[model samples]
Target: MNALKNEADNKKTIAIIQTTRIGDLLQTSHAVKLLKENHPEYRVVLVARKKFATPIMFLLEKVFDKVVTIEHKTAMFGADNVREALSKLKKQLKEINEQNIDVSINLAFSKSATYLHSLIESSNKVGPYFNDLHERVITDRWSQYLYSTVMRGDLNPFNLVDLFSSIIGTTKKLTHLSNKDYSSEKKTNLLIHPFASNEKKMWKANRWVEVIYQTLKKNENVKVYICGSNQDQKSADEILNSELIRPFKDRVNLWIGLDLKELYSKVDSSFLFVGHDSMIGNLLSFKNIKTLTISLGTVRPHETTPYALDNYNLAPKTECAPCFPKDECTEFKCHNDVPYNITHQCIGQLLNNNKINIEELNSSCSSLSLSRVKLYHSDMLDNGDLYIRESLHKDQDAKEVMRNFYHIAWTSIFTEINTSMDIPSFNIQTKAQLSSQSKGIETLYELSEFGKKYSRYIIEEISKNTPSLEEIRKFSAKLDEIDRLSDLVSTSYPLLAPVIDFAKVAKNNLQGNNLVKLSEAAFYTYNEISLMCSVLYEFFEKCSLINKSKPEARENI
Candidate 1:
């Protein structure tokens, strides 16, 4: 054991854990590069999900000593599945243990993160908690987690490359560490990531239409390159087919489904990146290239916005606010309403500003705080003044109320489709189905007169005595405290601790609910509630049977 320990102490072993989606994996890859560059001698290993392993593995092949792939989903879900995943993880742990890993950085923040510390056998485990997040010196922004050294804020927003580099202690600059070297080429083509992950996040097609028109009108020598995943080919094709955009088709090149390295090479060569708040925009910042990103909703530029070398972000003010899981609006009015002229004017200004050296332009990126934004409130609730006034006397009826509840549920389910699929490109049938189902629920809600009347009755009865959201939260926390106390009491008895613990868990989940990610809290609470309800119902039924049997015995007496 002394010899083994001595051998482990001789080498500096670092393990990076970021087993999430493709975008997150890519972001953490830059950190690996920075680590290798800074220390050069330390042995580094990256733990990635199977799906994200391929592209990032290929990118970081030469940077790290080894790439470790984990079955990300199995480890993420339940305790049993996590145990099973850990069994496989033990082998890697045994290997890294032999080397005595000095540092472990977790890029993901989930319930399963604790498992990584034990499996890796590392002394230093740093990551984001609800507290103790990191701050990047270059970007001057607090990173999402403790070990996350990557500074990604409004002024230094990044794609995966820049994010990774920041964490590893590099200057605030984007560098594409590709296998292929292109030292002699001049980039005449501009890469455009016009589509976003969601239609609501995408700049209007007309905006793209104008960008292409103006880009060609000014720099006739410059070519346009439209980029996306294979799933996005249809949208790209539609854009290509448009007569307005088609005139420049000869000068345009659509490169979807290219290999990751090839795409990076292309993006590296491009003069500018113009897109919405997609991963592509973030990726562009890594290359240290000029870019223009259009943002919408309550997505604070400081928190989630991209970092462009020489560019600007144009987001308009709206009444609905950053109603992120918005259902009331039939169409996404946020993205639809950003003025096209504003985009064109911004692009024109940057093009004229391109006379400066690229290095100076890169350093000139500015940070816009949530408070500094004058045109719009950080939250859309500020614009609630625009909403139609409501009176206390009016209330929705039962049928209408049922319809509204149904609509909220259906919309929530449809939203789940996007999250569940995790496809980067536009999925036609699924997208259409989501839209249709949501609209269908809305139509039902509007037509259900009986639901509306019954709902009104319930509302009238509850309105005079209803608790505010804050009160509900406090009450839920108090319930959790009571359950915790009950657990302490039951532990002494030992027989009822399981039931107490179960109640404690249910109450705790209710108190820490996140309204944005409704599925996480709602699903957990509903399951716990169902179990408790079933237990109580069974207990009552047994008691009623016992009482009837006693009465029968008394009759016999």
Candidate 2:
């Protein structure tokens, strides 16, 4: 802490890099604002792409002492245009280096951002950056959490706003920008943004038409505004031309090609904002507008949903939902499953004459099976105000959530261990205990191998039209042995307790003459136990390194 204070005192220029799209850049603003408020002496600087930076230059200038723009689009044009873009980029880099930045924080996790961070001559660097060997190294714990757990795990409950705030050393609620009081405006207007960058994220044009038509029919005075950029004009036209929406054309306004200021003005005056996961939704969130987002396709509501006082998100209840962008899926059930009727109901309630009550809406709509829907609000605590909320799906069984959590946790631990195999040493007693634990993990691995073999044998027996009783008995006995070993290992290392409990539950659930079911269960158990073994192996290996490093410290242990 003293070292950090001395560093901050000596060099006060902090450079924050967020070379991403409009939404992500806007999201990073929370951290920027907090950083400025906390460290008033630190001259905060921003590095962003020119395209996005130009639109929000006014906001950035107000928050940051200086804003540096990178011509990212020109650089990516082609090989022919690369020389000029690189020359310009180099000039900008020289200007930034001249500022003698003390701290450089790369908020965007991209190859370009990492490369840029590596070039900056700063004493301290936070977030992800590339080493000389081109390996990505995340220096901050919060950033590592964002990369490892939040990006992949569905069980993560922290909002990105909270995570960003934490990374920059501020956990308090961010101070909102003062704007026109739009709360008093009548809730009859619905701002609908139907377009997203990804096709998978956009709802069917017909669905938008349905929502528009139903809203107009529900109330005579209700007006629907479809907002988008020039690129989305075609889709906006498709929705406006639909037969259902044609009659309401007089009431519907297509605010297309509006600049950032114009869009902010429209959203500010509007009563309710409804959209997919896109810049408009994020922008509205920045203004603290009441929004309802239909998160689908690759959008993870827990990660990207607009943050506001009472924003609502509707996502599918599928287990495979909120999947990775690279994950191939033929059905894309997330987009198809969101019922239009529910959307209509949500609109009606928001525009109702009575005051908005989020709790009422949540209670009434609980049966929709919207797993990741959450209400964002600030709660004051003794330490500071925080964005308090339950897990993505808090109502699910604790064990079920723990299963997913431990999988991601163990996987992340193993990945880190594999990357840097530097483990400290402990004393003789601790080394013995670690050795015993390693052996137990090896035993679990052996049990998993046997389970896999037994599953294969069961499949072979089914194929041969011969169900052997002796083989079944042997498999059951192996399962009993596995249970005993799991109990011992879990008792030694409490972290493996959940895995043992899950295995026991799964084993107990297997019943009747279900050979195929048994095979599947065996395969699943084998994979899960194998993962646990990997976790243990990495844990003991780290212990071994620790013992090797500090012989005297080991004696105290």
Candidate 3:
């Protein structure tokens, strides 16, 4: 037992910790199934919160060999029952530790999850865990990438499912939910989950009224089913009270009473699920039910769109969209941005065969309506990971343009999996933004070079016959100044936020403990950052110069 303590390579058991909500668990399930399929020898264990895990234990039981749950509410018994809670937590951790876990991955980046991770005995760890000094540390590259880019902003290009797959050290295989035959069914039931966990992500009931009315009016044999939690009774009343829905009252079914498992079982392929960015949509996606997600404030569609083929997503073109939760919002102009007509059209098309009429929708919809929203159809890549393609690219914005580059950059930089990533065609405004942002890239390069210089100095000093600790500390302090200066560059050019964010994570999760080893690790990180700068600079320059009469500019970047 003593010799095998740190033998991570010998063990085949891996523990995945996902203590978040239902949607996150669904996404994790999608990624892990691929890992299980490819390496059936590995025994997968799960660590999740009791509250979240209880809802979907029926599904979790099939995927994982052992499921250990943390009783969060019990653990927070305040001053009254703290000892009892502590005893339970210790028992839970001891149970997990005895499983002989080789790898313990914390996909849920909550503070509680990090605390739990520190106690679990794993030969190797991935994702965030508090070290002995009580400082949060994430050693793996993919987890570091996730920590840096996700939740920061619209800068993240890859979907959550894709990122999870990357972190699990396995690519998602091209195994989608099996195709279900819905043609035999005469009536097509459309499941609409209009409410989200947060208010910012959902549309008002009145707007949904227009959508339901139009959908029932234009399409025959189509029923609209509404589902939400019991807490959403008041909001559901608002939607149900609409006069527009009066004629189609017979077709609209509200099944708020059904638990998650019941809802999952009841909704089949014949039912098309349309809603805001919510768990109902994500849960249904596992069964390969078609989903139409309308992402609003604080929801980045690129990251959280339903995981499957032929699904759809709609998000506003509002500049402050996918805004931070802390931001002020008197009126959700982003909600108003998606007109009912566009949504009705989308529902009709997908109802037919789970395909959006890109050309027809673009040619038919009013220019004013087109100007308000951006439409994307979700599809998976060769490796079975999901991606969304803009169906209507007539008004592709600058932010979308940069997202494309970073999609290529991040995938290549982290995974070393180079894509045949093409350069996006730019509009006048995008070209202007690109030109200005390139200068920020220059500043980034300068800062990165200085970082490399300091790292080198630290390494050189540590290599001396009689190394001076004070001299080494001075060089390390200079590197800290350089890292601080990098924030300024991102401030001036928000487009370079991902670049700065990634570098910060890379430096924080540096390899080695001693000054000699640590200094060399810092040098390699800065060196990599410098290389990333070169790649991004080349992309920016190529974009600006693409207008020239050169065929080479048209080639894959």
Best by TM-score: 3
The candidate with the higher lDDT, 2 or 3, is 3
Q: Alpha carbon lDDT of residue 241, candidate 2?
A: 92
| Clashing residue pairs found in predicted model 3 | none
Model 1 stretches with alpha carbons more than 4 Å out: 1-11, 32-42, 74-99, 128-187, 268-270, 297-300, 304-311, 317-331, 355-557
TM-score of 3: 0.92
- What lDDT would candidate 1 get against the real structure? 0.45
Q: How many residue pairs clash in each candidate?
A: 30, 11, 0
Off by over 4 Å in 2: 1-11, 72-86, 171-185, 353-394, 397-557
The CA lDDT at 79 in model 2 is 33
Which has the higher TM-score value, candidate number 1 or candidate number 3?
Answer: 3
What range of 10 consecutive residues in model 3 has the weakest lDDT sum? 548-557
Model 1: weakest 10-residue lDDT segment is 383-392
lDDT of 3 at 2: 14
Per-residue error for 492 in candidate 2, Å, reads: 19
The C-alpha RMSD in Å for every predicted model, in order, reads 20.0, 16.1, 4.5
Compared with the true structure, all predictions reach lDDT values of: 0.45, 0.64, 0.78
